[model samples]
Target: MINNAPEVLRYAAFTTDPAGGNPAGVVLDATGLDAAAQLAIAAGLGYSETAFLTPGPTERSFAVRYFSPLAEVPFCGHATVATAVALADRIGPGELLFQTGAGPVPVSVTAGPDALEATLTSVEPHVLPIPQADVAEALTLLGWAAADLDPSLPARIAYAGARHLVLAAATRERLADLAYDFDGLARFMTDRDLTTLQLVWRESVGVFHVRNPFPVGGVVEDPATGAAAAAFGAYLRTLGETTPDAVLTLHQGHDLGRPGRLRVELRAGDARVRVTGAAVAIPADVA
Candidate 1:
């Protein structure tokens, strides 16, 4: 329904540098754009995902939809953060609400020392066991063996907004060599309704290194993935790995050379996980 091309704002989420974090296309006002139009824009941009926003019932609430190059997804964490930071740049930092396919997400934007940061509180998250057969198939696609998996962190399907299969690598080297069967993994994920494979390695008690293989989203890998980080927090909590009020640090994108950091916080008595990160606008010429 859009007669003209809408202005798309590009921002890199989870990093202060425009080139560091995961790049997400943000359309602040996608009022008349239909699903096809939105998908076209997303595919043209060719980022991991893009977010479209329309006015909601409340003044500060918006109906948000996310799309990757290949398909529409339930939610996208990095896009949400990028959109919030972009809005804060225009309207100033404050609280905002986003109604998404997964559920209602409340985001708070605040001024940081270096740049504006946004924290989105996810809907209640849950973790479920992955069937051994499915896990074996995924491992085969990654060329990883059972012994390469860390015993401490068992494979599980975690969901905050989108679903991801959490796999822990026994060693950092194993996590870095990530060449995989692209088409096969894409088919595997599509069949099982998986968004990404969250491959992680713990550096310390509260610090971790992560990578997201997003074949289903038509990307080889995601530089920084906020939704997977949120789901990881829930997965850790369900495994009794951390305290109720644990604040975990996730380091991502180093392997791809676009380093980004994501902060995952678990509030006491609240099942919802909070992910905080900084975002910077990418110039149109370079975006």
Candidate 2:
């Protein structure tokens, strides 16, 4: 197969409306494309990330690779959702095992009257406290004062399929006004091997607002962040914050003018976190 773009299906995950969610490129079959080719394609597409799925007839699984414009990432939430929905178009909605760089991410697809929904089970997650100095530097880059942080959620680095630092803003206003030193923040995150800075503000017991600064991925702000959602689930578990059977609703990208929602489910017995979202194909000619 020629692997030249492969019809580049565009899908906005975590929202039914294309104008509301994070856009990702989905290449159903990319067996022949090498890493360099994939990177070139992703950069050409110009979305936050793209998911390339290699064909496998094993009934439930396939090797999946995620690439940003500048580099390859271990995992990406929106792209995974887009790929699962894209697969559902051909193979019918069910379960799928994705062998990603991070680990095996099991995705389950369910058909809705409106669109297809995908739920991805993240790899086992963990959280580590961020060093004070590191936190201070990050705060400085973000132009946020330490007093603006929410004491309840403390700063920590959370990992599910990838590593992300979770910083809680004390107020919604603080979360909305996101102006940061791009180069400085990128340097800090790169030095620590962090993927994105998961900035959040808790709205209620089970509802929160989030924004992700993905400088390392060459994006200013991620409209919808699936990886950060999984990592946040782990962070909550580590802190003993949410109820075992709670379903957390995360509203992201509203400030960026593209509103998206992510449903994060935490099971009492399962160590793997589940992140659910709806995905729809972006119209080909719309650009």
Candidate 3:
């Protein structure tokens, strides 16, 4: 048994700027830590989610778990990107496999001129239907009406690694104005097994802006959500809104003032989706 405290590494994923994007806590060596300890660490860090890693099947692999302040999630995309980039900074850019609670996720990291970037390929993705009554309740909690929704963009639940409810707003103004019943939404999400409500607005055919309300993770919002991005790509494909092979640009976190960008790439005949972004380590002392 190990007694020493595991070191926590902080990284902001989806942007080169430390202030942009979502910040995640990474524990590179948590083999000795129990779930309780991990939870405590995550609670201390106060990020939306923190990733814990142990040795996996191969030298370039790890068994990963994600924890929020309030609960444990099956997967977390921003945390995954943060962990991969942290590993790449130490071990050099290369391919990595993460054995997660949901499934195995393949990731590739590269050292770029600006910073280290990581791309994660999601497992097989699928879209599922949500009860209209539940959707209506969610809309009420979010203070949005049925008329505010985009008719062309159907609402559904999408899963790449974790489940997210996709709701498309008709206009950018509607998407930007975010006010919700936090406790009510959290209860609703818990009962429905949802991670976030992927509130989105299509700026153009291929360009979109998104905001994720992650009540289940004990966070009011997630600045950059890679899992949701992958799921969104699958959503668009399943809806026949985009070609099977195309690049999508997602701009998130701007309203929160921590601007971030996420790249979602879909390949022809491949059910899996890929989300890529840059990550940078944050200083412990700085708030």
In order, how many clashes per candidate?
0, 0, 0
Candidate 2 per-residue lDDT over residues 1-287, each given as its tens digit: 23345768899999988877899998887878898888888998889999998866697688999999989999999999989998898889999999999999999999866789999999999899878999999999999999999999999999999999999999999999999999999999999999999999999989999999999989999999999999998898889899888899999989988889899999999888999999988886655
After the best TM-score superposition of candidate 1, give how far the Cα of residue 86 lies from its true spot, in angstroms: 0.5
**Candidate 2 — worst ten consecutive residues by lDDT sum?**
1-10
Candidate that beats the other on lDDT, 1 or 2, i.e. the better one:
1
User: Could you give candidate 3's per-residue lDDT for residues 1-287 as a string of tens digits?
Assistant: 33698989999999999988999999999988999899989988899999999998689999999999998899889999999999998988999999998899999998767999999999899999899999899999999999999999978999999999999999999999999999999999989889999999999989999999988778899999999999999999999999978999999999999999999999998999999999999976656
Residue-level lDDT of model 1, residues 1-287, one tens digit each, is 34788999899999998879899999999998999999999999999999999999988899999999999999999999999999999888999999999999999999988999999999899999989999999999999999999999999999999999999999999999999999999999999899999999999999999999999999999999999999999999999999999999999999998999999999998999999999999986654
Give TM-scores for every candidate, taking all chains together and pairing residue i with residue i: 0.98, 0.97, 0.98
- Candidate structures ordered by lDDT, highest first: 1, 3, 2
Descending-TM-score candidate ranking: 1, 3, 2
Q: Give the TM-score of candidate 2.
A: 0.97
Q: Runs in model 3 with CA error above 4 Å?
A: 1-3
Q: Residue 121: error of model 3 in Å?
A: 0.5
Give the least accurate 10-residue stretch of model 3, judged by summed lDDT: 1-10
In Å, residue 104's CA in model 2 sits off its true spot by: 0.6
Q: Which clashing pairs does model 3 show?
A: none
Q: After superposition, how far is residue 247 of candidate 2 from its true place, in Å?
A: 0.5
Candidate 3 structure lDDT: 0.94
